[model samples]
Target: MKKIFLALLLGSPLLNFAQNKLSGVVTDSVNKPLKGVSVFLPDIHKSAVTDETGAYVLQNLPSGTVKIAFSFVGYDTDNRSIPINPGENVLDIQLQPSEFKMDEVVVSTVFNKLQSQNVMKVDHANVRQLQHKGAVTLIDGVATMPGVSQISTGTSIGKPVIRGLSGNRVLVYSQGVRLENQQFGDEHGLGLNDSGVESVEVIKGPASLLYGSDALGGVLYFNPEKFAPAQTVMADFGQKVFSNTSGSNTTLGLKTSTENLKFLVRGNYTTHSDYAVPDGDRVTNTRYNEQDFKTGIGFSNANYSGVLRYNFNALNLGIPENGISEQTHSKTPDYPRQRVYNHLLSLNNSVFLGNSKLDLDLGYIANTRSEFEETATPNLKMQLNTVNYDAKFHLPKFGRWESIVGIQGMHQSNTNKAEEFLIPDAATDDFGIFGTANYEWKSDVLQAGLRYDNRRISSEAHGIAGVEGSFKSMARSFDSFNASVGYKKNLGKPVTIRLNVASGFRAPNLAELASNGVHEGTNRYEIGDPDLKTEQNLQTDLNLEYKNDHFEFFVNGFYNFVNHYIYTAPTAAQIDDHDVLRYVQDDAALYGGEAGLHIHPHPLDWLHYETSFEMVNGKRKDGDYLPLIPANNWNNTLRAEFSLKNFTDGYASLNVSHTFGQPHVGAFETESGGYTLVNLGFGGNVKLGKAAFNVSLNGNNILGETYIAHLSRLKTDGIPNIGRNIILGVHFNL
Candidate 1:
């Protein structure tokens, strides 16, 4: 356990918006000055550490209440609120001894509070711990959480799936900005770097009231790394080795914070050869390389605070077209490779009024994707640019109710540069308004929200409909209203239950409305429909939890009914040298649940056992199974912990994940077989010359099983997933 101490002081109030400074000294219980004590203001993203003289200063802070947290080794964490004014102020703090228990704060929902006090059920994980487990990517680490999974084209590309919904239904928030990366395609993956990310929070059900559109399935929110403590500068370096791919991933980052300003930067690079399958044969054209960078700068004053961030990602991914071949570990990819680049910039700001606060966020994203076939020029090219904005005002609290009213919207344009046109050039605009509130009382919490949205989509003509049977110039408009209500009750000191009902809707994307010609890398030629109704759904969720020092248990269930669900399927005729498919709509329903338990006996406190299972079923109104439905899964883990004198926390775990056979599939989908894989990992932190270093070793599919996943696009080609991979990583902070 670590021990820490903190003290917050309120400075004299000032009416003007000017720079404010706070200087303080930190001392131990013995009255001796302590050096290297970390001090931070969460709301302003500015922080500093005590110098050799036990003195710390915070500059350029907003004039209002701010949350400051102090932490150090061998001390308990201290966090509290302090008022800042427009002039210089002085305060001193003393440290004390206490036991260690982490107090986590959640920010995904509008109500920013500790998870223990939040009414909504959320799943969260520490990125540092996930890194310790040697997860190669952010999605891979998130998949370990209950009810969360990823749909993969291969190791190099994947998208997140929550419960039973994926693709455009799930929303991802990064750096306080909604991520828009042409997510409608199966080959598109989240173009993000995990180097400087701090944590992840997952909402497993409908969240349309908070987020206007594309929240019908769920949400994944990523929190970037915080600024360094005041008076301190830090850097971290890490490297990982991939056995199956004969690859390497390396990252380096640095951060610094002063009185009123903070900055951080990170760079990462990855290169991998073809991935090896169960039979020791390499999957041809499965190699890739990536380069990514992220940086941020923060500034604050008495009246306002803001941070500007930028992220750039470039990848050269090989789109597999050949069969299994003799082993080759070349870095140069095959002919049919894809080159993708993304530039994202965002600004987040907060303004404090007399008794309320206003929050604003702005973001812009530019994506360029191209495919190079046999020729030197790209065979397919597409460029997408989007700008989005969000604003919210927290109303003055009245009694026990906390409320916020907000408006958010996005403007996007899509254009094609190659001769082949998959989807015509299109422009879209969407806007929404929402208000949410929470009522709190002794042992019970009530929450509700309402939202309304309008969307317009316009596409340029590609060809005449009568002769070519293709899409012409078209336009469409859609609007919908959504609402949600939830109640949380505490049964006792160790039991709790929550019930929630929510409604959500989604407007059709441009591809569904104007797509024509054959889809690259697939056998189907898709024809879009100009007339598609908006999709709407209602879901009811129930959650139960029982937790204590020795044991933990949880269960979650949900049922959803949707009207006018859109899907694409094959027709009776062939078009453009391929099987014809048409976009269609129907009513659909889906229901599923997840359950888990964890135990640690009193006498054997160092040993633990855990297990969890998840399953979902989806069907159309005609009673046909839905496509791309994930199979039922069961996971088990056994672990033991031990502490070494003069060393840090250490643990070892053995795990197994079993996926049941998927006999229920769509008309064109094939049944998948069941399979189980074993995984093992262990890691520990060590202190070396005033620096902390972490090391971990993890193994996946140790037995090298050969199997196909139901959601894999390559499954139809009888391509098995990667097998028998060992990963080793080391991270050192200085």
Candidate 2:
């Protein structure tokens, strides 16, 4: 990593260029200046808000073709590609008025584009938007997206599931790098806090062509908060409280930026008591607390820009054992709990070379996980360290075509530090090279990409050989070639259609290949299969969308086929009084779709109605249903937006969600019953002269419904999910 950084530094001289300036005016369709319109350049993390005259200026910009976005409430967002020269550049933008929300630029994809312009459909949501919906946790907010669900142990422990796939099959990206935190275990959760995050983007189908192995299911990308605008200093404080869990989340942050330098820091603390059910009983040992710190520094000039970021997170998550046996409001966790520490550091750099650019990202992650059972010393502990690197080169445009080539790789190691072990000490390596291109003509757009990846894994033997709780030494290598193609066309002025096909693969993880011990979290003794082959899948997606002045509608469908799909099944045996399960492979298929619509009456623009339905089905070639598939869901909401005398952006909403009974079950799994839930939210921005603040009040499960989600790990134990939670939040900017 040092050598690579040094080489790039020495080559910077050749990439330098003259700085440019940009000044713009924004107006509405009626030729009236629109005050407070936001003008942003995502590539350089620079932004400006139009003044009373709708004028904005940005300085010290690189001389190249850059993408700029202009947005305001109740207006159609506009994205344009502007070519910068050596001196001053003047541009004017005219935005169209609409009742619909503004679309955001998606960063998860290779080429950053607005949702309406991308060939592939992606879901984008801001953290503030999710918070307004009364989400208790980051994962909870993510599960609200259509076609996404979670395998949750409690309110604090959640694993994302996309289209019936979870675990290592899905990849997560944070701070412009892949998050490595021992994700193979079912009880593991996303080790991230939403305090300093800006937004999230979801790619719902095979993304291996861009991310490589482990993207067979999908990708979840988190975008960190941007630096303060140039020549500005900003500070903010936010707090939220929950009733059911007696939980509180507090965050404080400060950021400052100069012409060519920027710095920011944020700290967050979260604590929750054992959650209560409808019967007013708390699930024993279901509490958790977290402490998180994030900081970043950035430097930019005319030709080069770089940002370095670091995050440290410490968590104590209590493992639920007895189901609804105790009632307490204590925040501290008891025995049989997990203590995890994560350290992540990343550096992202971009160099402009005339019309082309080079981008480099390097990351390092150290994760320590310990499980304590009945004693001060941990019963199981593991340390995982990973280093990742990615480099992408954007070539100059060739007429109506644009292209990029990239290389990516990772080196990882895992070691055991406690007496008992679930998996052997292992080392893994990965390498991949890919190239993708896009062609656009009139209202039609086409995109294609191909990639090749190689992964090697080696492990050291552990425990007594031939013993029931022993693991044998092993070495294995897997290789695959993947490809993806997508096309988008405008069927008419108000309609568009998109189709995409992609292939992806996932190499067997260490636990699946070498485990031979009891997994206390699941209360089962698991055995691994070293002969397991790579899991490969091909997926096809189709999407259609229609939008007009007062109404919008969309429908999306997908089908995926997998080869050598790996799963665990129970055997007619036992180990240490625990059921014995063995890993196995079979061919499988999954199909799913989502449909949604939104309407706003012509004169009653403040009144809005929305509804969506999502469904998925998975089965093996032999006709057995897949385990952990989410139940079909239908959600409806009625919302009102208004600007009161002393408040702006005020809104209220009522939502009703219904989940259908899941009758299709795996061989050893039981069916789940259906249920309905109602939720309410109310919030607004309060303006007090020159000072302003935001407040929100949201209630989830307002009906106090007692239910169990089909994907809950505690479902088999007859544990009901949390009920009747009310959340109150306040945020202030200073």
Candidate-wise lDDT, in order? 0.82, 0.91
The 10 consecutive residues of candidate 2 with the worst lDDT sum are 9-18
What residue runs in model 2 are displaced by over 4 Å at the alpha carbon? 1-18
Candidate 2 scores a C-alpha RMSD against the true structure in Å of 1.6
Residue 399's lDDT within candidate 1 is 80
Residue 350 of model 2, lDDT score? 86
TM-score of each: 0.91, 0.98
Relative to the true structure, candidate 1 reaches a TM of 0.91
- Residue-level lDDT of model 1, residues 579-689, one tens digit each, is 889899999999998999988777787788989999999999989988878899999989887778646678899989899999999877899999998888888887776
Global Cα RMSD, each model = 5.7, 1.6
Q: Which stretches of candidate 1 lie over 4 Å from their true place?
A: 1-41, 47-103, 464-470, 688-692
lDDT of 2: 0.91
Question: Best-fitting candidate, measured by TM-score?
Answer: 2
